[model samples]
Target: MADGERLASVTWLFGQPERDSVTEQAASPSQPTTADAPRGRHEPPTRAERASRAGEFQRINNVSMHALARRGMSVAEMRDYLIGREFDQHEADEECDRLLGVGLLDDFALAETLIRTLRQRKGLGRSGVTAELRRRRLENDAIEAALEDLDDDELARAIDLAERRAPQLRSLDTETATRRLSGFLMRKGYSSGVVRAAVDRALSRSGESSGPVFR
Candidate 1:
């Protein structure tokens, strides 16, 4: 009877493992007892999984390219677009090449589109459009080509721009107005010679002489 009682005591003490023992085994470095494995959180994705994600990335870039073209993107404009979206250089370059290859992007076409848009909407001249195209990183050949198409349109717009802004130009004294008009036209992308000619023409049309004569 004493031995059976001792056996019962042994069973109660050690036969079932303690929860603390299980926890210590789990906390042990060599073996992980639970699927949760509590140490390393958010492990990096495997190579195959990364490859799958890269494919999805390319697909999304393709869609974004078409969407940008729909909004009238030139080569430089597209570069700016990708930069704005925080695309890495490699991805942005690849997308640029793909779009250019597929005819969805062209620098000359973009320059022409800008010229037309600015002429109708903003009343800008050839020099103004040329400056803008250059700012957009268009090739010299492309800029020249776009400017060729604006010969008549640009001259007319220049005249209108000068006429419309004449009051402000004339508000200054004649010498001041000449200087101010020159600066203004220069800011609008006109050459110094062109600005001088335009200023002379405007003054003559207003019944003022070629020399500095106050109104």
Candidate 2:
């Protein structure tokens, strides 16, 4: 085709005010585009809904506290238990504080009771009692206070444990008996010095010459 014919064809194809039409559409405020459209309103929770949620949290706290009370749980133990049960940390802490405030949870009392029970019934030494208290999440101060009562009688406690265990090992030879007794006391968390002395007294009473020496 001739250049003038081609130019006329092009002009006819795109010569209309397409840009002006788009500009007019964009400038018109009557029509709202996606960006200009109003957003859906969000409703806040009602007072009743908030109260229901709070009631649910209280119920959970009450159930947990009651169960722990039945078992005589310490504050830390209850908190850990509640957390393990999927309770919120802040909620668990609040519940534990309530229990503590009412004396339903007492770490010091728990520690003292456990110390006595471990020593008298379980044949646990001071170290053993401390470890048990720590495992129960008792504070160090509570543990120390409880242990203070054991300071004067810890040796006697170890001796009683050794004497009780000595008879069972009577059939073994002296070396074997001493070795077994020492190991038993050590596993019970006794200090090496205490174990040695207790083993000696126990073995002597049980007709053994002396306790086995351990490095």
Candidate 3:
């Protein structure tokens, strides 16, 4: 038999003898002893079992948090991931809060970093950045901060980006070149005025159509 069954059998066997004595002891409360001790500490979960439970929770938390960090999780994304897997919402919230409180997650900081990366590397525009930040569930404050900083010299950056890619559109006719440049600027989130100015400049430099190519 298993240890638990064996122990239970042994307990059952000795239980009859102890029953009368326990009743007598209970009837007389003049001198209490271990036999008269309340059925606490020895009942329910033992210390080892409690310790094991705590250890399991700790391990689960560590592995999950590390996996999330490795996967580049935002707070809401992490919450959604956990919820999609059937984790209790309250528990997920608690764990997410703990992670955020301990600096394991910072959505605002992440949004700023992403904004810089996309703008500098991908040549994305303000609208694109805002959409990306929204996808990450970042607060408006972070989005606003990123946008505010971008306004300082966005025109210069956009001009530089256009210059680098202008060669690609150069092969096309003047109408095509103007159309391409305007479309590019529009897709990059530039204002209509900015896109028009850039496209005019590009067409002029290309010795192409000076008339507006975009209707």
Candidate 4:
């Protein structure tokens, strides 16, 4: 009977350890795993994040304004400048529209200003002015609208340009002078008719196209 009691006590002690181990494991807090993480979460921007974005946009706006002050920029140009400066595209577009609403960025106005500059300062005629406006990336509607303001003065401008350049051709033969003068005026964006008329009038005035005098 005493041997039987001893064996039973030893078994009970061994079983207590296993029971304790199981109880401790069950009572311990579980560590969160990836499977327990929040699914499809999207946190809203904090105040600091919002402030940082505002400051960034303000800097972009200032840069655009300074660029405009330095020289005229079309709406497309301002957007490109902002994007090139690493601003977000959507934000850049928003700022551009804001400026446009305030009349600070006007494609039509820019086109008009460019037209005046090319015509008066650079002596470019209608086609040349249009080409330059397109090069500046103005909208097509703005380009057409701005061009409407131009007076019917292409012929006069062409004549003036030809007269200025005709004196240089006095040394060349009449045929050579005519050819060169025509090319020059054509390159200046004058039409063929305008070029022909200007070349003829210029040569006649300079006596370069005179008939042979009788001996």
Candidate 5:
């Protein structure tokens, strides 16, 4: 793809910039204004209206921050959440910037924590974790950085996952066990090679004999 196309694809994930809602026009005191002048006749927002808008934004920000306090959220996730709650996109973006500035939202940190939790607690492989991160709309750099840590331990992790799930399949025949366990590992995002190896190891440990069942 061309550079422009690539950039477009990435930007498509976040949508377009929102238009500003409030527009202000200033008039010179010495200038003569006509009553029929569209520009002169229009009144700018009042101080109370501005304050009310500011308070609304603040309330939205506070609610979002409280949600973040309970658990980490990716910047895109928070922005989308605010937008879904009827906050203007520009205002939502401002709130996201403020939170990010204060370190309340860190995509890299969120990616790392999510990667660890998915792998250790949920037994998700690199592909599974990557898909999850993308679903959360994390930046590509953050996702790559988090996935870097999985390079050395993927096979071992796959084996461990298979081993843990091996017992339930022990009652099945060798072919059935191999098929079931291989499918399970594949669904967890293990590559065919890793799935085959893990299934072989798992079935062997369970005293079942099966040749390579995956290519």
Candidate 6:
């Protein structure tokens, strides 16, 4: 009887704990654990898979080449173009550097070419050429450099334009003709002084007076 009583005690204490341990071991994988928990909400992105830079560079280069094929672009223009296409800024910058090195993107050269076109084809004055270069995103230094080689016949060009336009003003009085000619030259990007001189010279040529007498 004592042995059975002792056996009952042992079953109540040790046996219960042993069965609990085995149940825990069997149930462990099914239950959630610290290691099995989902990733934190604030995990850093460095561990995430990233696209290859080389691949990105090649794609950007392709896009840049296609854009350049259509028209010559300044460095800033190409940069804006790449950014508009959703390329990364740093990557776009590197590609621009590459293009500049290869002579594909040249702001100064572009400025020079545009200056000639603006002068010869469009009949723009120095101010007009400078404004156009600015619109094209050429640097200030580049604009200055391009303007340095500009043709020295600005006054002549302005006079030519004014003379051509003066005949239309023959019906108007001297004051009216002078005012109209001055306005036209100013809009063409000539300075106030240049406009005055051009108006006088042009009016003289159109027989408005014997010659410009500083008026």
Q: Report lDDT per candidate.
A: 0.72, 0.81, 0.74, 0.83, 0.82, 0.84
How would you encode candidate 6's per-residue C-alpha lDDT over 1-215 as one tens digit per residue?
69999999978997898899999887888778888897788874442324565566678889999999998898999999999999889988999999999999999889988987887887788998888899999888988888888878888999888887887776787898889889888888888888888888787765436433222
Candidate 6 structure lDDT = 0.84
Ranking by lDDT: 6, 4, 5, 2, 3, 1
List, residue by residue over 68-174, the lDDT tens digit for candidate 1. Answer: 74776667667767767787777777788878898878888888888888777776656777777888787788889888877664445555666556666554677
Off by over 4 Å in 6: 1-55, 208-215
Number of the predicted model whose TM-score against the real structure is largest: 4
Pairs that collide in candidate 4 are none
> What's the CA RMSD of model 3 in angstroms?
12.6
What would the per-residue lDDT of candidate 2 be over residues 1-215, giving only the tens digit for each residue? 99999999998779667877898898999989898886566866779979998997788767776786587777787888888888889878988888888888888998888877887788887778888999888888888888877756667878888987887886788888889989999888889999999988888775345532222
lDDT of 3 at 56: 58
For candidate 2, give the lDDT of residue 121: 80
Each model's RMSD to truth, in Å?
9.3, 10.1, 12.6, 6.3, 23.7, 6.7
- Sort the candidates on TM-score, descending order: 4, 5, 2, 3, 6, 1
Best by lDDT: 6
lDDT of 4: 0.83
Better of 1 and 2 by TM-score: 2
Candidate 5, residue 148: Cα displacement in angstroms equals 2.1
Candidate 5: minimum summed lDDT over ten consecutive residues — where? 17-26
For each candidate, give its TM-score against the true structure: 0.58, 0.68, 0.68, 0.73, 0.71, 0.68
Which pairs clash (backbone N, Cα, C closer than 3 Å) in model 5? none
